[model samples]
Target: MNGADAQSPVIVVGAGLAGLTCALDLVRAGLPVRVLEAADEVGGRVRTDRRDGFLLDRGFQVFNTSYPQVKRRIELPRLRLRPFTPGVLIHTAEGGRIRFTDPTRRPSDALALLTGKQDGKPGTGPGPLALAALGPLCALDLLAPPRLLKRLPELTTREELARWRVPDRVVDGFLRPFLAGVFLEDDLDTSSRMFHLTWRSMLRGTLTLPADGMGAVPRQLAEGLPPGCVERASPVAALSAAGVTFADGSAADARAVVVATDAAAARSLVPGLPAVATRTVTTYHHAATRSPLREPTLLLDARRRILNTCVLTEVAPTYSADGRALISTSVLGTDAPGREAALREVLAELYATGTRDWERVGTTTVAGALPAMVPPWPLSRTGRTASGVYVCGDHRATGSVQGAMASGTRTARELLADLRRP
Candidate 1:
């Protein structure tokens, strides 16, 4: 049924972070928008599940307290936040562990490499090998300048390592592992623009989480919308100028159709969609006997396989009941293999605690979770081919929740302008 002919209203496909945000924005604008979700529940990747009175998130995710876009767009109080206690611990196999905190309090944190007693640790800090790599890696912040990325396409991880007069030892020991945690990619093959964006954000905010798991953000977005505005478990098979056809042969019409799903799903719905790049992030959640670390730190393991380990409970105690905690290990390269044996091998390499009789609480590997925010990442496809067709998602903006929300708001703003254009 055409939107002008249907009994309902504007229909948005996929009630993920972007879709929900867009729908809420449109509804608040009094556009009478409706959201359609493929899953039974809301929150595409940002999901929270309750088990044995403990709240569990689908994947290991964190939010930057400095996310300017999301912070300005949403009323964060709705999703109780748990801020990290101003520091991160890097647990290493050979070098031992060190804590890096906010530079404001410990101004020495920023000069740790030059200062011999940085963060109260031994040596000049981060070791000579790691320090050597920091030179070019730190220079990446320069790319954040206005439009600098256009001229520095060749300034990628590989390029920076090769050009910076740094040694191969520094690249291997420091740059590789450090960049892995930031980009979640084993290699530096990603675009230099993404590298700069990550660096800028690093300079921008503190790392934090919602008390109710990462899912709370999406939940808040969904609840903000009008009742009966979102239809769950209805996937859009194809979309045309007339309207959308669901997998069950049901159709819904709208004056404007927004594709707020993942890149692959958008390709299926919109023919000849822009080329998209994808990356996988593997999260290992452990229900341990005791809390691993009291404070949250981005663990950079020398093993190369385990990118980072985040103690979620310490970051946000509300995620688990008192006396119980949740720890997550994110593997950057590939999705955890389906074969139990391979998974066990990877886990053993990650936690150094071999996969054994310890019961696992929950584990997830997001195959299409992260976008390759590298160079050539596509621009916003909002206000695409048709007058009433729109697109919004992380794939259309930066790959973070902030990016997704920004895309949605921009779409709504543009839509409103289009309505008033006449």
Candidate 2:
């Protein structure tokens, strides 16, 4: 290494959002930093693919505007974000559809509830009066600031919901599938703290997709950094307190090292690290001549065959070209044989249309999509593994994009503070 190169720049492993965020913060502090990524591009799990004129995200993902870290780091207007309708459509087990909309966004729907006009809807889900009554309580409980949520005793999400007086019908019909999709689990065993935070985020801002794709998020972060700071397709074979060794038998010296890869990779680098369970998710994309559901609303399956599905083209027309519609479906855990056929059958029933003509585009399975947030989960953990060695990722905190960025920022601040100490 040259004299300048050997001068101890902070080395960051993996060019995902967490690593990129840390690098950007370090750069802003006028500190020299280097990022190594195994993939050819940044964004790790957050990627986009263009196939047959369809922009398919690596997995079914959504960008929330309410994440404080996102607001601080991202230029929202540049993304040209397209939003899903502020509510969801539930396909009931009885083969009926129920529409649950945010009263704040669609006052007409609220008015319909007040006038008892919603009773005419297909599914015998929660009645309008019941839904309207719960809205205020939900807003007060979930939309409260983070400090308030932190004060509450930690509990599993299912237990927390049990404490609430929400009707069983509402929980089973809507909240179950909806929260399952978010937590990537059907049992609602995630941390109640995470549940409240996620609920607050959703209530505070819209769920959106960039005009380009989810990959645009990481691209934006990477673009803001100094050129050549991120070295793609350079995988680190092992790590130590001093620096890292590359797969090519090369080594780099650094004052500090941050392992910002996924949970599995981070554990590999630092043995005996606390284990964080992860959830798996599989997303299937298909093309249709016309949209099965014309609205840009997420549809949840009450039967739990499919966690959640959305018409991506309806939410953002750029996802598809030539008037073709793109439908994205997500299922929890690994897919089994005949899963595609079973999913298609479920889709046909849910949309009340035939799926035989829908062209299957592709399927992407992420085994470690999000770290499982169980009770007693800490909002933030000390990123330091040892002197000069640290780690951060979704596993170190909550399991959302917001959590990932926040953890990265925390690592950056901690590293800077430690480095400045006398």
Candidate 3:
């Protein structure tokens, strides 16, 4: 390892959102910073692929516009975001569909909602009253003051739902599928705090996808940084207060080091860190001549075989070539043998269409898509590990893009404060 002066730049490992955010903040603070990423690209999990004239994200992911960090950093208009419908369409176990919409967004629908009609159509689903009843309850809980939610005792998400008086029909038919798609778990065992925060964000903002793809988010973040600030394909094998040793036998001296890798990678780099459980997800992309669902609404399965599915082309035409449709389906788990075939069969049933001609474009299986968030989880944590050595990622906060970026910002502030110390 080469020796260096104490004035060397701050080194950030892993060019994911956390690392990139940290580097950006440090640079803006007038501190020299360098970012090292193992992959050729900056986005760790947030990546887009162009295949056969289609834009496919690394996994099925969306950008929530309500994230404070995202709102502060991202240029929404520049991203050319396309929004999903205000609410979700739940395919009930009894072979009917329920379109649940946000009444606040569609005031006209509120009247229909009270009369057991959805979108001016009579409800033809299992337990229409139950579905209608869920609307007011959800709105009440979602619109509850942030201070009130914060003051409530921590509980599992399931318990929180009961406290909110959400009925079993809504829980099984709507919340189960929707939350499974978000949390990647059907049990609703995630933290109630997380659920409330996430739900509030959803109520306050729209769920959207960029016209170019999710990768555009990280690409935008990296674009604003100075040239040579980020070194791609340079992975750090070990980190210490003194500096970092790269896997390529190269070394860099830094006054401080920040490990911003994923939960598993962070643990590998820094021993004795708390172990975090992660949720896996598998997404399958298929090309169809026409969209099964013409609307841009997300569809959930009440029967619970598939987590959720959406027609990307319907939401953003840029996602697919002209005259072709792109369907993205996500399941909660890793890919298995014959999984694709099974998913195809399930999709056919869900959409009530024949899938014999639908072409399978790609399948992405992410083993550690998100860190499992249980109750009593910290919204933020001290990034300082040992003096000049620090760590930050989604694991340090909630497991979302917002959480990741927030952790990075928090780490940068902490590091800056420490640097200013005598």
Clashes per model (N, Cα, C within 3 A) = 3, 0, 0
The lDDT values for all models are 0.68, 0.86, 0.85
- lDDT of residue 20 for candidate 2: 93
- Per-residue lDDT of 1-422 in model 2, one digit per residue for the tens? 11324358988898888999999999899889999999998998888988999999988999999899999999999999999999888887777777777787887776543333334754465776557556655776656778888777888987887777666777787789999999999988998888888888888889999999999999999999899999999999997545889999889888788899999999888777877889999999999998998989999889998889999999999998777999999998787799999999989988889999999999999989999888889988888884347898988988989988988999999988977776
TM-score of each prediction: 0.83, 0.95, 0.93
lDDT of 3 by residue, 1-422 (tens): 11446478988998889989998999999988899999998889888989999999988899999888999999999999999989888776766667767777977655544444555566544354666556664575578986676666789888977877777867876788999999999999998888888888888888999999999999899988999999999988887546988897777789788899988888888877888899999999999997899999899898899989999999999998766999999998888899988888889988989988999999998878888988778777999874347899988988889999999999999989988877
Regions more than 4 Å wrong, model 2? 1-6, 111-121
Worst 10 residues of 2 by lDDT: 110-119
Per-residue lDDT tens digits for candidate 1, residues 223-251, read 88888888888888888667788898887
Top candidate by lDDT: 2
Q: How would the candidate models be sorted by TM-score, starting from the highest?
A: 2, 3, 1
Candidate 3: deviation at residue 40, Å? 1.3
Higher-TM-score candidate among 1 and 2? 2
386, model 2: CA deviation in Å?
3.3
